[model samples]
Target: MDEVSKNNVIDFDKEINLLRSRECFNETGFLLLRGIITQEKIKKLRSRLEIIFDGSSRLSASIFDFVAEDNFLSLVSNEKINRVLKQLLGKSLRIYPNLTARKATFSPWHVDDAFSGNKVVNNESNSQFIQVSMFLQDNHYKYGGGIDVIPKSHLEETWQIQEQSLSESLEIFRRVRNKSVNIDSVAGDVVIWDGRLLHRSSPKLTEGGVDKYSLMWTVSSIQSNHKEFLTHLENRGKLKESIENRLYDARYQELTHIKRSDFSNFFLEKIKKLDINLTLKDSS
Candidate 1:
């Protein structure tokens, strides 16, 4: 590796060791680090992201739709971010093509693995998934829609609290709220957490509305059975065949019946407006 790559690897190792020892995430279900990315890089990324969001109508509709945009995936393909992810997750990581949400969007409190029949156990080995959110703008508690995490919630074995009704969930949030840390991040600050942790986006309370731009990515260990997991995404009409073919090779054949025609015109139009070239090079 070159100097920059070498330095990043070293730094990543340090962060990984720190992450393992601190228990900060277990205690809070989140951790924050400042200056993770240079100011210049954040400016460039924000510029590109803003153009995409400006043209894409989906961003205003719902957080799920906004996150499924192709341009958002293109943005997260950044090498610097991927390097850190590789160190934390391993080289066989597969990134989900989702960006979490922008302003006015809120993710309900739940665990990603809940649908898979896995409960949040005390051992990390039972945690099958991880999520990382890279903030491209400054987020504050007053801004609302900021992420609220239940510290050490991932260690709980049951979904007793998470299964409650919305009102009940909010009441639980109010009671066990150890620390409601607003992820006030300037561009490039990344927050990594266990997927089983109980997390919800606090409502956006900004005046006249404010756009909270963020890049969210998930990573799973190699043994996490991504093929089966990806099949689930594909069946849900979330994965494109073109990328799926490349990622899964012959495995795509098994899922041929699940493929759907690409209908993400809005997502593609935003990419064109941003002027970011996205032609995939031939692997052969």
Candidate 2:
């Protein structure tokens, strides 16, 4: 597909206006856009991801690394998504560089803000931010581990659970009587939801399990000026101390074994092939 043809920008103003009128968002706090990404692009990205996954020493390490990597970042910052974000959040949209990849296991019901140390504003009349995710593969209902959202749940008052009671969060899943939508999306389907939405991954019912690959990006309006330092701390705290320690311990080992310069050259070549205009000049 031609670059121009591939860049399918959605009308954000119309979408937002429609969402405001519909109680669907207020009731579920989430919305899905099926097949937002093109099939060809998805195939190319998935192929690159498979190669990266095979070579990476620590697949479960800091999610930020994956977000920062050129292959992933390019897809997340696609022109279509950027256009929508510019309309929704204005010109100065800052993307949080953390891409979460949930493997075979079910995630407990929780708000994105739960891990952030900052308190959630209890205002349904206003929107602070929106979270967008692109699925890299199909997450069928039978295969499971797909995201299950409680619509408009974000409008409710915020509640806190003690750190020790984290396991109890799973109970919310049982109460999800509403028909849960499985995001059995093709490689390029994009899903966007309000940041305050209550969502969790459904259990991966299949015995062998599936790798649920997804990239998440957060878009905040320039006015919000949300704090980032505290957010990072909260994310760090969510990981087990032992796992965090091991990741740190293995970081240097992985870096030493791989030639940073060679990786840089590879990315530079790939960027040239993609014909992307990089604002910052590469010193190398």
Candidate 3:
């Protein structure tokens, strides 16, 4: 083939892969990028995370935006993560304040969009909001623990999706569980999911083993969906007065979804626009 033709094929292939990744996420509302970070990076972050936990009782299994140190913040700027995010959230991806670190925590089946079943039906422009989670262990039967998701279940919305009983949610899950996926990821793997997707913590199949450690953050391109989800989060946060008016609040609070996405963006955005300290700490 001619030099020009060869170059064209290579460029075309690259463009196609980019489009395919975003297309898949639009349909499924989640993307699992295998080994997106190095194991060494995961180890360092895990060590620091362990220190942050300071050997607290395993009973809690979570820390709310505990630390925004540089190492934890750098994961978001990882090249592979940026690439996928650019495809999904456009070039203007703005991260919401707060980073959450967790160890072996579990949450029941739920949606982050105010528990609304159909508010996020349109995954086009509204797909700007996404959660990026990095797991520090292999998700296998023996190792156990990962996230389970309902495929395409994010494409619906109601002002509020009534909470379902465990048995009831399970019954519904059982009916369409075949269409869902339990992300079987490994250490250093990254899972980026839409805010509206129905998901829950995958259980540890074995009785004993080191627990899983994960770091998560939320980012979004300006879109209408952000407004809806934020309103839902703020109201829930106010229910328990979990909303922290401070830029870098450190209290443990459960305000629906990941507490990182808990505050109203109006609140976060106001702080962000001021070029306050909420932006990622420069790793440079």
Candidate 4:
């Protein structure tokens, strides 16, 4: 992959318009943005994540909630990301806890929003929901193990295999596995895609290859009518005091001097559900 030139600064306003255009999402369910996170930033985030993941069994879980590491949260609340999100979603957008840590390895074919038992479609041609994931390492198709998606899968009203039995679904997954393309990307590149897309992780073919690391943030358009889904997105607050403090500090800085207590109060809503087992102790 060609490295993004250091001098190649992006015009975010223009980029935002292109992303919000119907033609872009119609052809591909995903958008790839290069140089969103810098190499130095990626290194810092990797170090923090290593400390958090060290000797922990949480990696086995599909989603680790409330990962309040400062470096990671800083990336999530990046100004550039917020700008794009504001264009996609309205200004009334509310971010979840700064530390929601999602780690995955070898994901089978699935949809992100479908996990909540809701089927999303662009019936109104409005941005219902989106997920932005920042890659912490380089990924390539030829080497195996990267994100793969069926183009325009989100435009479908329903997923046929979703209603089938496990055995039947697995057979269908096998058939469509080769039809998808591996979304290869470099470290610090953020890939934003509609949550309705049929996507999954490609298996790592090389022996002893390192597992991919990514940080993800999910946001919903304020105009979306999915109340139950939006309610679930707003659910938060099971983090330890130490973790919560880190989250508060990171968010405060990101928003530039927002009150810590107010920030904490804003995020501390009734817990609808805890996605993963919170058995790990605060390393801080």
lDDT by residue for model 1 over 66-119, one digit each (tens)? 434554544455454545444445555544433344434455666554322443
* Per-residue lDDT of candidate 4, residues 3-68 (tens digit): 222222233424445444434654455666665766788787667666666775554211232333
Q: TM per model?
A: 0.60, 0.65, 0.71, 0.66
In order, the Cα lDDT scores of the candidates are 0.49, 0.50, 0.59, 0.51
* For model 2, the run of ten residues with the poorest summed lDDT: 1-10
Tell me the tens digit of each residue's lDDT in model 2 across 171-262: 55455546345444445666666676666665566666446566665665545534542244344444534464533323222322233243
- The candidate that wins on TM-score is 3
Q: What is the Cα-based lDDT of residue 131 in candidate 3?
A: 82
Model 1 is weakest, by summed lDDT over 10 consecutive residues, at: 1-10
Q: When superposed on Cα atoms, how far off is each prediction in RMSD? A: 10.7, 8.3, 9.2, 10.2
Error of 2 at 178 (Å): 3.6
Off by over 4 Å in 2: 1-27, 55-68, 100-105, 114-125, 161-167, 228-284
- Displacement of residue 280 (Cα, Å) in model 3 is 12
Please give the distance, in angstroms, between residue 145's alpha carbon in candidate 1 and its true position after superposition.
Answer: 6.0
